[model samples]
Target: MAIVRFVLCLMVEILVLPVTILQYVGIWDSLYKRVFPHLMCRMTTTINDKMGKVKKELFDKLPEFASSSGLTILEVGCGSGANFQFYPWDCKVICTDPNPNFQRLLESSGAKNEHVKLEKFLVASGEDLSPVASASVDAVVCTLVLCTAENVDAVLKEILRVLKPGGAFFFIEHVAADKMTWLHFIQHVIQPAWRYFGDGCYLTRDTRASLEKANFSQLNVKNIVAPLTSLIKYQIVGYAVK
Candidate 1:
């Protein structure tokens, strides 16, 4: 057991430490921004295949919650526009992400998903959505984003600020596994390296707790296990009204 543990630690150092070092020196950000969109695009098929039903159920409720003739949605952290196809036809989408490199990929996705109109892609973080007007959008969508947000509370506030009265905020995010479980232990063990490789994504964020405290007018969230890696399988899928 001692020898096995030593070997595993050595492997982690050899494989993961260099990337962590690059991140520390700020070289990783430039390289990751260019590479991540393509990687996400490649992985979209598998991800959707596993989580499509939940996403459909979440997005299908847009008309029910929205009180607009032409739905205008603001999608935060709209990486590679993975959710573009899921949106209702003719809905106008405003996309935002911290990484500017995703703009090209988002446009490409918009071309493919021409059913939904792509209004524009803004390079902005979720915590500061000053580019969007207050109470403007019919709905706000955030998928797989809260775990990586620098300030989840600030992002929630911004989401609330931009959404129209009675407009809904839809989210599908990975969250921390139950405490004291083997998966939770593994998540902690690999979190340092995961954050470096995944561009600030936290392996053990209590995002549900943050949402519950955000004081949304109506909040309905539930836990589900996604067909993803064990480290990020435990997830929450639901919407909150503001």
Candidate 2:
């Protein structure tokens, strides 16, 4: 049995090797982008109800979330426009995503949320937001994105740079569970597979720590057990003001 297991593991490793190489060279991003919309469309359909409840919990608890009318908001990694319905009327939005394939979905969502102006759909990475002006945006929104960032620190710095002095960064992200727990152990074990299949999403990223380290003027983060699978159940939700 042990020998058989070893042989199976080696076979899996061989299959994954080419994908790892592609990811390293950035080709995997292009390939993933092409299929991401279809995959997410199905996923959103299934999880929309559950995710809606989670989003409401976060948005309701955060003050001024619905009243940020007329403010310019930047949404980093605005995947398929899942958060569009949450924005209030009269809030102008600038959305940036590395995948240009999301453009169609974004436009469709923008059309539905006619009140919120979709200022620009920049094909950009969160790590280097050169297209967005420093300290210009009133707020930044990120959800389930930091894990995939090439450099979380760089992304945080760029987010800080782009936000106005008193602007807020709203986020909801799955994070590493408490140490010594079975869930944590599983997360660590499945990280290699998860990161590859989940679009470079690391299962063990300490996103809250990164946010705190960025020295936000006010950090009101809360860890909650989301209605998701164990591997990604623990999520940090709230906003940090600059």
Candidate 3:
């Protein structure tokens, strides 16, 4: 079984060698950034359909939690603006992402979801949201993004920094499976390759634990298994208050 596993891993590595080489030579960024958004665009409908109800249940609360008449939300890692449709009507959104290539798709999504305003799009990572002011946003939304963060702790800190006092941080993230589970073992096995292929997404990250340690005044997290591939089926969904 060990030898079989080695051979399978070797085959997978061989299949991904070109991409690995491109990443090493710095050529992958140009291709990946452009291609990934389009791929996401294709998958957006299916994803939204599957996850829309839960997203709405969480996102709809933004208006009630807002300190102002109108809501101002800052979305970190806002790829393809997938969450745009879920925001409350007329709420302005400040979208930040490390990949600039998603801007066009984001704009397109904004156009389609006219109920929510796409206030601005900044080319920024979650770890550094400097363009946005401290305690400015009424809410921060991070969906399916923590897995890809280069620094989860730093990203959480930034989220806390930008949120107004009493502001809520809504999140939906796929987390590592329970320890000693078969899925956990598989996650460990594939994590290195998965990170490269999935754009820095760590398959085995204990995101809920990181969130707990971030010192949110209130946390209401729940785990659920979404109807997705087993690799990322285990997920956490809920909100934290600053």
**Clashes in model 3: which pairs?**
none
Clash counts for all predictions: 0, 0, 0
Per-residue accuracy of model 1 over 1-242 as CA lDDT, tens digit each: 44754565566666887787887798998898888888877887788988899999989998776564779999999999999889998899999999998899889989999898999999999999999999999899998889999899999999999999989999999999998687776676667677877778998899999999996999989999998988889999999999
Task: Give one digit per residue, the lDDT tens place, for model 3 in 87-147.
Answer: 8888999999999999999999999999988989999999999999999999999988999
Which 10-residue window of candidate 3 scores lowest in summed lDDT? 1-10
| Cα-based RMSD of candidate 3 | 2.1
TM-score of each model, in listed order: 0.92, 0.88, 0.93
What C-alpha lDDT do the candidate models reach, one value each? 0.89, 0.82, 0.89
**Alpha carbon lDDT of residue 204, candidate 3?**
89
Report the lDDT of model 3 for residue 11. 71
Error of 3 at 92 (Å): 0.7
Poorly placed runs, candidate 2 (over 4 Å): 1-15, 22-27, 60-69
